[model samples]
Target: MTAVSDRRPAAADPAVAGQAAEEDLRSLFGQSTAVYASLAGPSHVVHTANPAFLATIGEERARTGVPIAEMMPELADQGFLALLDQVYRTGEPYTGRDVRIVLSPGPHAREAFFDFTYEPRRDAGGDVTGIRVIGVETTQVKHAQRLMTEHRALLEQIARQAPLTEVLDGMARCIENLAPQEVLVSVLLADPDGRHLRHGAAPSLPDFYNQAIDGIATGEGVGSCGTAAHRRQPVIVTDIATDPFWADFRHLAEQAGLAACWSTPILAVDGGLLGTFAMYHRTPRIPQETDLALARVFAGTAALAIECHHSEQARQAAEARARAAHDELARAVRAERELRAEAEQRAAAAAELAARMRAAAAAQAAKPHPERCQLGGSPGCTAPAEVKIADSWGDSAWGCLAHAEEAIISVRSVFIASEELGGLAAYLDR
Candidate 1:
């Protein structure tokens, strides 16, 4: 009879045997988690694959009796098929870690990463017969790492108070880059009253498209962004071509090659609107879970940047107002000082005028007790001198009431003498 079996291993220590058993279990169960497939011949024909392989490459595309390159043409341009060719020709195992691969390769293409190994299979004759592919999908892990890195960078930018425009532009580019499918990002800042929106950032969109939508009103049926702002909620327009909200801008959307737009209103903690964040798609499509998650995350980031900018502006305005008030107060103080000085000068001049008038009256009293008019013009007055007047220079004159009153009014420093009032009082007594 033929030998049924002849396989044996050297005995090991107890600890070594236990470790070996654990390794064997790991190898069996861990490989099941991976995608496995076997290709036959130099052409790398797909002979068989597990469910994981079928799921990864698409159930419809997975088939036997076809070259792997023919089954997945997108792999040819991405250097994967070349690596396979090299492994098949050399009969050497090829292993790749975190290898990036593009699937589908078109508008609907997606990026994926795999940690995989291609081991060459050999017969009893030591001739290479086929190749075995064992791979584990690392796409989720890779994407998670990238998302964390990009998010951390954005947070750092915000913490350092970068310019709003720079932050917004970087955020837009980051979302566009991170999205699995093609998406355009737009951020529109709201007016202080939230009645209108001004363009903030739209790097991937056409200039014409951005210009056309700038200064759009925030109201119902205005557009996706406008409606979202009006309602303080998200607005998703899956098909802009048929949506009544886009009635006025259908032609514009067509020109811009946008068929769907989803907008989320960015609001402050107190419910005040800050702005709107939007995502546009070329084809009419509904948002997936991942898409909505991304929008929510970045919308909050945009809100932070916008709020910080507004706070800075408000602080600057308040500082300016304080400075202006201080200047006004200083001016008022200087004006008060000038007015007080002018009043003091007027008081001193009046005091000097009064002193000279008193001295003039005393001199006049000593000069003459005029019986008749001694204070006349060139022709002497026969009428009685009834009143006495004196000027700032102490020059005195006695004349009738009319002429004395005229002289007092005509000259700046002329005044009625105290001696004349005494004379009039004596005359009245007599």
Candidate 2:
């Protein structure tokens, strides 16, 4: 009342001024799109609700003087009533930014968020009177933030050269977990020739379905993924049973419990086909804007991962070839060295043998005798030694026609004497 009374116009009573102030405050808050509600008493009974508040909590239940807990029983179990009690008891405002809440049940259940404040209202005596609820929904913003964080993690995995299956499988699982609704993810890699798609990863898809579609060719009317790869764009088949493109696979898709598929082609930077990313749904449903956005993001990531994997493979192959060539060259050098060494050894042996033979011939030639048959060993000859001879022991031997030849041939190193000049003619005459 101190500040309020000072600001009041002349002739306006305190009660009238206070009423006018309350009306002004109501007018200011009424036009706001933000959800606002006022509750009275410790039980937190709904006393007033703006259009935004009524819209947020279905209009039929927005009656005045109804307890908040009785009107929305779902909130009581979700800790909302406890938050109100804490604010009422402590007289302290409780603010929750991006608080998650699930509304309704069954297929219509929606996940939402609110940036809300529970402020304690005061009376004329400064006692806690009631609670005021003011909030702005931020579910979309929260979801966007989550999408960015998940998408960045996927890129980091790809940049670090994670295995294709691990990356793709992890990506599929992430999308399935982050998606607002249930979805199944599949990534099929294009063959090098771009004619066929091989199953790269499909953690949520049935094994039989995965095996049946492995190595599927890229062509028109070949189902959503195949057509998207062929066209190099996105293809959406809202209902597999009725879509002409899924005619061939309708029965198989039904068996796998998939009613719809939306696929986007993953293209390299040069516009070449890398692979296809697909999202499957249980009931026939069209893709939302968020769904398409998610597909585009992961599709780009898939392209990067596949291209990097291909580059790594090519590098490993080249390295293997280079190593094999190096090994072959080393082996050839070793073999050449061994051959040269063997030839050198053979040449040395031959030279030593030749030297021994030449020395023997020289010693035999240094002392000459009259011409006679030289046959000595087993092939016996009765020719005479045409000169006298002696052994190293100084034993002299002589013969006519045959005995002298036998002694020289049988004795080791025995030969004709250099000074026996008349011996040859005497032996020949005998």
Candidate 3:
């Protein structure tokens, strides 16, 4: 027997569920990391703004009761002011998603993106009065996606074993392009012993500046990259002009228009110092969270790239050595084979020479020694016979000193068989 209880969870009310979802959306894009503003009249004077809005522009320019275009004059050129005016005139709500914006101008200008809406506020008479502005800054998210794309590309380059110089140079250029403010990127590779840092890549830096810092010693107070490599950590030089680390390199830095340098040491998986990754700024400024984050991310990427390169180089070197050793061994085997053939040829020649000597001895057994240079051919040597030469097959000849020595050298196994002879050593002594 089984008993069943008739109990079930109640269904959520459509209106109440909808309201809860709306509140969460508002909290996400309105109260947190979003800009809210109220404008007055058709002229679009700034009536009020949330703290996020003030922070988004600049805290120093937090004063209200003024036109936003006047407060942020750069935005006028960027077309946001025109969009606001159109909303005020038409009384129609306008929305934009992931719109690119430049927050400031000049060399140190910052770039941003925003998803925003401009809703026309109505009066009691049903006439448009002002505009309500709500915007969520999407700069970080957009930049993060872009960074991931670029970082993945770099990893692919490493996996494919791209040249180290090409990888590093491309990385420097990519960072310079993506940084929020004007910055130059530089990479310095550490020497094998970690005693010095050599210029790896500096696409935006001046040639003179790059050359001057090439092979800089890795030690304390030796500029940003060198010091970072020496310590195997990040080194922040917010003001190159004031930092003691840049004391020696101050002149070079000034010539290159560099005011700040933040460097991170690219380390191997085993925690050994590999090289340095640096961001150079035109204006003196402290690093923000994003700036430090970028350094850490790219520093790791640089380490991966450098380690891959070293491994590839080592592999190539090993292959070359193996090829050389194989070639040498092959040559040695060929040489041994050739020597064996030559020795066999010499043995055959020796056997033939011995047979010729034996036949000549059988024919002239009684006259083994001749009187006047018997070894001469065609013309007879007039010199008196001086020595006798003989071969192993019982053949002998008597001849002048010159013919005797010549016969002994030309005929294998032929030796002096003279009863009276003066050695060359005794003759030279006399």
Candidate 4:
């Protein structure tokens, strides 16, 4: 339709005008989550506020006809009151981008951010009357940016092969700090057999609590971490005191100041159980969507670190085994070479003895008897020849009984030639 046709009818119905007015009011006062408030006079007395404005400042303090400083006393010290005053006095609009403020006081306080404007509302004569505040909370967006930054740091740490404990501990602290609500993170690693859970890291947990839960068995009703590890899935125990899975661990949990735990099992790419990533709460509480999302993101990170550690361990073990086998094989080869060398030496000695015996026999033919023991060494034996020993080569020798026996043993082919007055018979008789 053309712009002229889309214009309001020349004669509009009264009911239609009232309905349009009501819709406009709804859009201004609510129907949108942006914080809106109107303050009158230099004192900045709150004239009206939208639901979003009341929610941000707290609904309990919601009221009109009161100064903004009194309703949000915390803002006075944060420089926001001065900004509003300047806008109203000078009639110059002021805008703040990513302005941070603490929403409440003391322990109940939470940090929030906003992109906001303080604009002067003027009369027909152009004199400033009041200030109109329009703001949109950027708290969630700010948190999301922080989350991505922290998550990136964690991924870098894992990629660099940092100590598993360091990576896990850093991740736990990151979640605890980033979460909108208070959270204590615990990581438990699963044994190879998937039958037990060993404490991995829990920076914020009490030492006693960590000790008590270390080495817990994985099975049904074995608390959040164990059960999650056993089942290889997420187990959300909104209240540990009442959950059957925590019956065996109730006292420890209570002492540790933990009222709730939500655990997600960390798994390998092959779907094998690696460990459990858990978030503990101080009060009985169910996890929000953001909480679960944070768990999943970090749980995957934990798995990556663990798998890398395991792979490195396996590789080192394999290298050790290979080195051992190489050493053993080298030793065997050396022993075999020594044995072969020894056998060759024995054969050479035997051949030399056979040649000597043949020469000795030829010399004996010249004189049937010798004055000294022919079998003796260069230092001839004074003892009489007592035995005649011959080898299969027909080489014979006359020697004392001791020398004869020595010849018999050293030359296996040698035997008694004949028995004389002092021959082989003497050896038998003696």
Winner by TM-score: 3
Residue-wise C-alpha lDDT for candidate 4, range 1-430, written one tens digit per residue: 6455665553366556644643554477685789888788989999877889988888788899999889889998999999988888788999999998988887668889999999887764688888888899999999999889998998898788888999999999999988877899999999899888889999999999988888899888889888888888899999998899998899989988999999999999999999999999999998888888989999998999999999988998999999999999999999999988988998898677656654545544454766668877898898888777776455677899999988777766675655332222211212
Q: Which candidate do you rate higher for TM-score, 1 or 3?
A: 3
Query: Could you give me the TM-score of model 4 versus the true structure?
Result: 0.78
Which 10 residues in a row give candidate 3 its minimum summed lDDT? 421-430
- Writing each residue's lDDT as its tens digit, candidate 1 over 212-262 gives 999999999998999999999999999999999999999999999999999
TM-score of each: 0.80, 0.71, 0.81, 0.78
lDDT of 2 at 23: 59
Task: Give the per-residue lDDT digits (tens) of candidate 3, residues 1-430.
Answer: 8978775334376546534543544455555667888788977888777778888888877668998877888888889889988998888899999999988667547889999999887754568878878888999899888888888999999899889999999899889888877889999998999998888999999999999999899998899888888888899999998999999999999999999999999999999989999999988989998899999999999999999999998999999999999999999999999999999999999788656655544544455455688788788897878776666566667789898777766766675553333211111100
| 100: Cα error in model 1, Å | 2.4
List runs of model 1 lying over 4 Å from the truth.
1-34, 58-61, 341-357, 360-365, 369-386, 399-410, 421-430
- Provide the lDDT at 69 for model 3: 79
Deviation (Å) of 74 in candidate 2: 3.1
Model 4 C-alpha RMSD vs. true structure (Å) is: 6.6
CA lDDT of each prediction against the hidden true structure: 0.84, 0.80, 0.83, 0.84
Number of clashes in model 1?
A: 0
Best by lDDT: 4
Candidate 3 global TM-score: 0.81
Q: What C-alpha lDDT does candidate 3 achieve relative to the native structure?
A: 0.83
**Candidate 1 residue 305 C-alpha distance from true site, Å:** 1.9
